[model samples]
Target: MASSFSDMGDNLDSLICSVCLQIYKEPVALPCGHSFCRVCIEKCWESREEDCVCPNCREVFPQKPKLKKNVAFAYVVENIVNVKKGGAGGTGGTESHCDVCNGEAAKRCVPCEILCCEQHLKPHQQKEHKLVDPGVKMEELRCTQHGKPIQLYCKDDGRLMCLMCMGGQHQDHKVVAVEIAHGELKDVLAAKYPHVSQSMESVASQLQQVQEEEEQTENSSRDAEDRLEEKRRLVCQFVNESVDLMKSEIKKRKMEKLSLLGKQREKLEKHMESLREGKSTMDKAFQELEAVSFLQDSKDLLKRLETMSHFKSMKMTPLPVLDFSKEEKNLDRLITLNKNFLEKIQKGPEEHPEKVDLDQNNLRRLYGRSPSLDPNSAHRHIKISQDLRTATRTCTKSQYPEHPDRFLYDPQVVSCESFSSGCHYWEVDVRSSSCWDIGICLNSMRRIGVESGLGENPESWCLEKHYNKYSAYHNKQKTDLSVPGDPERFGFLLDCEAGELTCFGDSRVLHVFRGNFMDPVKPAIAVYYDDDSVHFVHLVK
Candidate 1:
């Protein structure tokens, strides 16, 4: 009975293998009581691993059973491999077959309508097969879905299409015959190829040239930056040197001013000391005079008898008038010294000579130069009389009432006729009774003369007199007019109760005098000139 069961198992295994149609190296039993090689079973499970069943019976089982390798099957495979090699000339086991040629072991060709072995494939392609040309094949190929060959070429649209496409979406589109389109495009592309190639070559060449130029520009820029840095360093050096020089000059000026101030202070101190000494001497002289008076008044009998009763006339010697002349001289010297010192101080530091040294070449490169500031220099000076004398006559007054002291003049508008004939007459008014003088002067002329006060025409014109009354002051005196006509000029002096007026050419004097006991009032004087006459007026408020 055990033998029968073993035989039954063997038969079942054989059927499973035959059903699989392959020798099982590693057999696996399914949950459905079916058996297969492990690879086949795994492949089946991969499709549906959860449902494993027998293909023949459709019987289902709970679990997949892992089967062991069948060593006997592996031996059978080894023996079959030897037998197949011995029976045929290098043919493998009969188990393998070609699908195209059942047992021929070759692929069948439709063009040749024959089964071709490996050795016959090339010959069949070369000789027996009616092969289609590639171009023809491409032209004859039809759309898979529509089964229509492409016909028309749409050059504007850039596409190939069939008659159906033309009738439908592309009906209104422009198209040409395929053959014609191909020929035209071939000509156009042939013609354009040389130009396109030349253009591409030119573009490449330009790109290389631009790159070289950019490199050169970068190098030049670097060189410029280096030069700029050098120039900046030089400028900084120059500025530092100039600043040091200026500082030294300032120090020198400061020392000079300090020295001047020190000298002025010493002179003032000496003058003060002298004034104190003079005051002490005056006090001593007063004490001596008091002592002499006290001796003369004493009363005693014996003294009176012994004393001579004769009254001797005492001749008094005058104390030297306190020589204020020396003081005055010293005071004058002090004034002059102080004036010089103050003027120097007030003048401040002497300015460095203007030395603009802008290099013309450099300045021209920066901006152009202008042609100004290249003219001759002009020199000017003013002079006035140093002497004071008395006004001999009276004159008129000024018009401007606010500045009672200021004198105004209408500029002497000498007509050409008057100037050529060489004589001009003008007048002035003074506003005082005190002693004052005026003189006429010349400007811009080589020859000059005066007629009135400096000893009556001692080479210039001047008038000096004491006018105590307004009547005597008014009477115009006609002394011999010294016509020193090279540029003979004269003016008038009017002394009023208020002030004095002097009008002479460009010179003027006003508000110079008042009465002896009264303070002098400033005079207002004006000069007006027409073609024929010059009038002088003095106004007092």
Candidate 2:
């Protein structure tokens, strides 16, 4: 039994201080069945404030525990100390002991508030020390600044404060209790973070899309440039083609002009050559005659000379020296050639020739002829009667005739009286009142005769005012006749208000007269003739 106990004691002595690694000089027992030097365990518990656990088995301790010094192990260590003695290793030098209070070794339990040596440590924990669990103590503690428990969370400020802080400086700010704020923030972040990430991804995608679009645009620009180049080339080609075509056309026109002018020059040259040939032939013929004369002998020459003198002495004179036949033929041919050239070069209407012949006998029967007609008359009466050979007529000697407002009477010798064939006419100005009666008489009379006794009355001639009388006379009998009782002949009366002229003799509406009678005192009447004759007459009121 003694040996067995000694062996057990040896095993126990082998376990040393976990902190200083030596045999325990002052040993303390923990509630966990672990042992350490009293000072080392106390220091560990005070500093760490954690559950005490055995270093070897990891068994946890309940609370602060008392520690005890092992005196028997100290005696063993002192006796065994001589064996381990060296100059630096004696019992006094190698010993690890608490320097404070230098009495029996003591340990302080922070929670239990006891000093203990090795033997009393377990009992001190059971009886004297008050135990506190670390987990429960942490739950009861509060922050030093806030009197209430700190529970609420502030996400923006990243702090925990009590309810009192919610109404203080932090009021009106975003805040929640710790649990609720954390939960809501977690949900918000969970929902929005992916969208933010997707937005970033979309930005990258858009950049790539823009890059591709830029490339396409650049390609399109290049294509447009190519098309522009092609268009420019085509335009240049068309311009050059047009220039060539115009050049060719100009050259063709120039050649045509040259050809036409060349033909004209050739014709002129042939004419000149013909003239030269004729002169040369005439000269050669004269030279041949001279040569023939020179060849005759002197006696033959004398006899020829006497014969020539005998021929010259005859009374036969040379006829008028004219080659009319040859000259006429040459002139005719030249004129024909000129006519052809003019026909080729002429561009517009040809002018009318100076005169045209008409059947005068047929025309005279259509229009009434004057009784004093002369075949060899020099003056043609268009609307006035004159001495046919001298173109002179008698009127009143004074400048003012009988009635100043009356129109003058003149015998008009018309080539054709038909309105369709057109005729020649004339007008005169009258300014005397004495001529008004004769004007009215002429206007009222349809036909007038040179012989006063030819009509019904011996003293007065018969005249008609109706047109049928003149038509029947001219168309059927082809001779003028007089009506039975002569009406007062008013000459061709120009009614300015009606724009008409009524004539009595030869009464087929011969003329329609129009006048502007703004000045009735000196009204001007213009007579227009189809045969290109016009005359303005002024009437005195």
> What TM-score would every model get versus the actual structure?
0.25, 0.21
Expressed as tens digits, the lDDT of each residue in 1-541 for candidate 2 is 1122223334544556778888776665555556677777677667766786566677776765545344334444443444334222221223222224333434444344334454545665676553322112222323445766656877767777878788876787778876687577666655565565465555545554666677899999999999989987996796677667766766776777667667767766765665565556545555665665555434544554464454434442233332246545755775697698778668654422211122223223332222222212111222322432111223322243232212233222111111111222222222211111111112122222332111222211222223334211111122344443433222243333343333343223332333332112111111112222212221222
Those runs of model 1 whose alpha carbons end farther than 4 Å from true positions after fitting are 1-159, 163-187, 284-541
Name the 10 consecutive residues with the lowest summed lDDT in model 2: 432-441
Give one clash count per candidate, in the order shown. 29, 28
lDDT of 1 by residue, 1-541 (tens): 1122222334434534634576564554554445567777566656875655665577655575555444334333444344434332222233333334444434344454444455555676666553321112332444443657656777767887777777766677788877788677666655665565465555545554666677889999999999989977986786677567656766776777667667766755665565555555445545655765544433332243232222222232333232335535755775697699889989886532221232323322332211111001100111111211111222333232332111122211111111111112233333332333233311111121222122232222233323321111211332332222111122433233223323332232211222221221111111121111212321121
